[model samples]
Target: MSESIDIVYEALGRYIDGLCGSTYIGTARGMVVLYRGAEIHHLTPLKEPLPFLNLFYRKGTVEIVGVWREEKSEAFFLRAAAADVRLFEDERTISIITYPRTGDMQERGMLIITLHANMGMAKTLKSIIQEETRFIKKEEVVISSRVSI
Candidate 1:
């Protein structure tokens, strides 16, 4: 795990704590902490060198998305539908989106986590796709910015 990943995990832990208010069980990996299982805090602890984005919620499910740079190209990771991942690079910043299961989305109690290096870019991306999909519906987006520690 890298220092960046540790920082991101700490931030995520704080966010999760605020929402669910439940004690979290996290798996430590070097400097990174990967959320272990279906547990909110254990769901996704990034490995390393990945920046924070934001969380989004649609209907009842939660989604976590983030963008990072690898080999000079933007890499996108979506913790949705088995983690939909992608990569991109250009004048615009990269974006990633994850949707929850259909049943969960319809429940309107899910939470979505979206992370990115740029807050403005993340927000714009979220607004653009907020209604374009139903993978995760009736949920809220938790937005977080990435910073070097």
Candidate 2:
């Protein structure tokens, strides 16, 4: 892993150690999932969609919706789907935002996490969108000014 990715993954490792449930970390290349306590899974994106039980949509600001999951023999895999994998070809992305699923929510949604890889400097987080239960949306300017690249 690169230095920046190491830093981010290190921080995320600490966070995941304390979570009681599963959490996913997506990158431009693939996904790293922490299931329960110490079970970790690395998954690659599937070109075609599968018959997944829990389907969700991954969308970016560019309006491209990518298929994000695949299931085979009762195992699940995830990909950082954004319509096209190449959309993040030049960027090093680490997903930091996601909406919590609720029973009453009509549709599943994902928040955009776009990061530009600037090896030794901090990258800017752009176009973060959050939706409320009342249908109100709040957009933040920058999530963190110190996200190392």
Best by lDDT: 1
* Top candidate when judged by TM-score against the true structure: 1
Give the alpha carbon lDDT tens digit for every residue of 32-55 in model 2.
222222432222232333222111
Candidate 2 C-alpha error for residue 17, in Å = 35
Poorest lDDT segment (10 consecutive residues) of candidate 1: 23-32
Model 1 misplaced stretches (Cα beyond 4 Å): 1-38, 46-48, 51-99, 102-111, 130-149
TM-score of each: 0.25, 0.23
Cα lDDT over the full model 1: 0.35
- lDDT of each residue in 52-131, candidate 1, tens digit only: 44444323233444434444222222234322322232343443423333343333223333233344544444443553
Clash counts for all predictions: 34, 1
* Candidate 1: residue 103 lDDT (0-100): 41
| TM-score of candidate 2 relative to the true fold | 0.23
- In candidate 2, the residue pairs with backbone N, CA or C atoms under 3 Å apart (3 or more residues apart, or in different chains) clash, namely 66-83
